[model samples]
Target: MVMTRAANIAFKPEHKITMLCLSSSGQFLSWADQSGSVSLASVGKNHTLDVKGNWHAPGTVVGLCLRGQRAYVLDDVEGLFCVNQQGEVDWHVPVAGGGFSLHEGPTDMAVVDALGRLLRVGYDGSPTDLTSQFEGILKAMYVSEFLVLSFEDGSVKALNGSQVVWNRPVRGEVGESITALGMDASGHLIIGREGYALVDGEEEALEMETWCLNGQGLLFRSDLKTRLTHITPGLGSVVCGFDNGSVTHYKDNQHQELLNTGFAVQSLMVRQNHVVVSSWFYLFGVEEGSEPWKIEHQGMPMLLESSNDGSICFFAGEDQNDWTEPEPIGFFSLKSEARDADPSELTEWFQRPDTEPERSAEEIYRVDETVENLLTEEERMLMEKPPVIGLDSLHAALDDFAFASPDDQAQGTLNVDAESLLDDLDDQLSSMAMMPDEGLFDALNEEVVAPIAPVPAAGEDQVVTCDEDGTAVVLLDGLGSEDPQNRIVMWSWVDSTGQEIATQARAKVRLSAGVHRFELRICDSEGQWSSDTIQLTLK
Candidate 1:
């Protein structure tokens, strides 16, 4: 069975851990607690406890970024500290400037402070400051060859590290904050704020893209404004986890809503084709190319880290000091296909179908009064289709191919099943040979045949049974009710004119001696009509 939820543990208060990180090689799973203590466990060997360190600080450990052998821990009071392989702090850089974001890359790690200063720290132990370029506090930053920063002033800037590349001033004047940011596969930077987008040449503001549960409009109204909580790129789309417990994906310049998490998504990591997100007590693993799946845990998990090698996932939360020790961390094997793969999967909420008509044969066309004039363009263009038997056509074509047409009579070569047609032909030739002087159909023209009505309805039997007095009578059953109150019947007279006659009430009419058409109409008490008509022949 797939392990969707982690087993529960008794609450403890002393060993309360909150954040976790894994080295890119997947050998170590490191965790930090609320008591300013950090622990490293060896997951490769039955999760053997390795070592831990306590960095006494006033505030909590907010985030963790791992590069190689060193880990950078961001705290609410201690700024950012770089710890090495020996579980010792290599250096502690005081971010007294107050930055809410800390990010690490392959070659360097950077932190953006409240003063809009993007301090790039490299392995050489020096800092490169990109401060004078922007006019607002940097709300979020994405680093590649180009560092994309979304500022509180509702603008986004593309910087080649510290130098400005291009900038788009957004229209969100209310200073809402840019909550999440990412670069799509197309390389156009995408910033998710309260409601709008900053892409290419256009900045689209929040325009009620969806309605909230309260029936109020949730507009993408702010430009690159509003604090972006988390962002990850998958396939051609960007998956963003917001402060509202809402996970949204942007594709083809359109926003698709995913899960509506009630709590803020604290950490989001994308591993080999999967997106793993953590909030308080919730962990969700969304297939990078597909949809999200939930993994159950009760106490709110704070930090989520997946194997950079795509082999495992780790979730850490504060373990209380109760008599029963709570599990401070949980492990998931990313490559364990048996556990990750399942046939039954829940669809993402943003993926529900919109209200639209179903596609089926019964709804292909609607017949109405202007059917002739309302022909589809393609049908109207086929006005020149020739009749099966055109003007002055001879009937002899039915038998003209006998000399050269091989008998495909079995497959209906001449409008008849081969066996039956051959049997009839044999009987005809045998009879002719046996009695040459006998005439075929000796009683031909002497038999009277009754006319058969091709189409029949409930009341059609009465119309054709009219007596010699030409009076037709019908019993009104269930008439004037809400159901079918009228029906139409048509009769064609053999020796009379071919005009069709329609009727709703029973009455006698002067007969014209030949075939006649009759129709019936029924209406309910409230004037609602039923739609059944029939055709018959009058002898």
Candidate 2:
């Protein structure tokens, strides 16, 4: 099955998770718990972040919303404080009455206290009383620049700048709380619950399991299945996640069942063809096709959130009564990462088919992370890009060998002593087969071009001394593998008398001696020569 289960992360045991929500920028999932502990996690990367600062509250965190890197939080004691990504509290506002929920807007948040005070808390660090227009708020929805507040008395008011612009009585009972409030693309408010309809006028009551506006008409669930724990509006569709272990997707009023995991489906989200859900102890998803997939997990699924366009998803699970940090889960794209990926990010994927093609650090369609190894960037370039041989990058063999430093060139003149060792090697090579070449050369510093080494005349042995051969033959592999720069422009042979014998690699010598000395030299393309001296003793 499809999975992005890269790794596991554990947290301190003191945290008791209460609520889960996405950051204002949708890049991270931030949640709070009973112990005043707040944590932010990167979704696609599967990591629980220990934000570099500390957040301390006198009581449990009641409600919070993350936008950008700042976390605007509310505590049980009617306290409102703003904490940034680094865990530093930017400001704190103490209210007279206890507050319950916090709804975030583009630039600020509207909070309702137990004393029925509808105050706007954000910006200047002080709560601005929004004229107490609604009380006992059942639910609040932020659309564009307007704050839509639904009160327990079944009164729905659309307020702009704390001033009521429109008021309407909802369809449910006076004390019934609104489960969902949403706005269509054209800015028309759609209220859902006992009976779903638009506030504009009379419309057919919707059979929506969960609803969302697709800019066209009411999009709702059709084939009702099991008990739903969560539902959300997706692009051009509505998605419902049921506790009956089923995820249903609806488009054009037709519903299709994607998959049924026998476990409790805690959360469900749909973005285009991508569907992400948390069920039982695992996070599962269906993207790009009808194939259902599962991700491995270490804890129970607790919270989930997704990008508006459905490119990636973030979910976390906490082990029952195990105070450690929750296992952060998310949907990874196969096309490219979210449009605003971090610079240091190494991978990108796409789930939405219609999404415009965007360049990524690495564009990988699918990665079988378990079995297939991840290729480095250089390896990928070598595998994907065309060969440099026939392309514009072609170069000569000599071009590859770089010029040595002046100091290195000066040190190149030093010679290696191969005296006795050369004699022993020559004796052995005298029994081996060899190849030959012929060339005429000037003395040591001859500007004339050099010929290749001479071929073995009749066999390996070349009698250097006419009366008695020093070894069997003179075999010169002097340059050997010592041509580090591949710049051995010429090789020279010298005798024990310090006179150049021949300007070739190997030659025969007539010597009358008890001991004799000889030298073999090599030159680089830079015209610098280095020599080795070998001594042979004849008894």
Candidate 3:
């Protein structure tokens, strides 16, 4: 048997939480919602949260980093903002694209934009551009005295200021890309869907092996059958969660299975003594010497973070329903054996007492009838007093239907030229009698041919490798399209983001290292159009 408990601290937000970050000391918590609101709170004794300040951003917050008394926010429309504890913006910078990643360093913040421009901003609102030093940064982290950056071409490098400490340019399979990068006590680790590598900073030659290369100072790699979803650095290794509901710790060229949650892991955190894993419906805390405790959540856990000292863990998510909007909820949990507290103090709002009577079927589905519920005010007014037909309106309609001649109406017969009508009928019968039987049969058997529409073919899916510049130029072919009239007048190519990239049948497009999907649309002269899709995998 395992012990179960409710969260010791809880908070409900007005909107769904978009991002969340906890400070290293576990004293301050910061989060952003869908409405572009950023909030900072102080964590007191007994895991209590006291909101200190709140600020609003111009767009949806994508990145949030909490340090000291300031919150660094990066939104989609706005570039970067440093909000102080008094809810005032200290500085602002304009960022162009939505694909920007933000990381906090020891002294400044590092930002990598969609165009691969790297910028370092100091605490005093000073900015430095280091874009020329690197090409297409996929991930960056400040470890020890060096900054480790991963590129789009599956290369990893460490830099000390403007100098390169070391470089590793090992490429993965066609559909495989780097998923996670971190520094452990052993070496630098790079994980992907197909395999992973651990590199130590040293000078060595290459030694090829069946599984992994033995060169470059303590490197290890192996294929993974299951897809990785979440990862976090452990004490001497790394903990990985998979889509198949299995968690494992990878270290020393081998991996040990931790526990299977029987569901895809949504979030993961590793502390000093235990590992906390959250699925869609439950949070599991696995320890060494005792049974793993499970806590049922009222919603799906979206965010999980641990303090630097591994003393407290924060969790937040949203309760989603079919007919209602998502409601955000958050809580914090203390490390096992960290402190002793009363269990009754932690309230579970979703639970009901056993003393309450169960509701009957009729009571559970009962709905009361009210005037406001049945009809709108305008509808009720229309129902109470219906419109009446006026005498003048009836008279106008009768006049419109009156006969044109009073003499015909009195005789109760219609005036007609009977002799001329018979003569016309005789002429029609004479013409029909003179027609050929074979000609009439052929006319009835004739088949109508409808116009054929154009068919668009986007060609076969392609797998292309990037060049030395970390980008590939591939030709999108739509010449395989077919049309009955051969009058295909227009051709359009659209990317996965719904943006038109080309207007010709065959065009070249430059793409970064990743997966890309495109759609091709062709229109003929007769205004008939068709579309098809093609996918490209860039390595």
TM-score of every prediction relative to native = 0.49, 0.49, 0.60
- lDDT tens digits, residue span 417-498, model 2: 3575577679889868564423333254467655433221112222244244333333444534354334454567665433
Q: Candidate 3, overall lDDT?
A: 0.69
Per-residue lDDT for 15 in model 2?
52
- For model 1, the local distance difference test gives 0.53
Q: Model 1: per-residue lDDT, tens digit, 1-539?
A: 33242222211236656666787777766666757776545554544445544454445566566666566776656577777766777887776644445776556666754344566777544677774544344454554566667664456666666677666555443333454565554444555555333443454343212112122423233222224567676645567777667776756446576666678887776675666778765677656454455665535566566667566666666422233344445566666542443323322211234558776665567545476687787886686575567423533543432323455434422443567668878999987785533455555546776433222232443335556755333332212222231222222211112122223232223332344444444433233334333334444
Deviating ranges (above 4 Å) for candidate 1: 1-13, 52-63, 75-79, 96-99, 114-116, 129-138, 173-176, 195-229, 242-249, 254-266, 288-292, 318-327, 337-539
What candidate 3 gets wrong by more than 4 Å, as runs, is 131-135, 172-175, 193-218, 319-325, 336-516, 519-539
RMSD of each: 36.0, 37.3, 16.5
lDDT sort, best first:
3, 2, 1
What residue pairs clash in candidate 3, if any at all?
none
TM-score-better candidate, 2 vs 3:
3
Whole-model lDDT values for every prediction: 0.53, 0.56, 0.69
The candidate with the higher lDDT, 2 or 3, is 3
For lDDT, the strongest prediction is 3
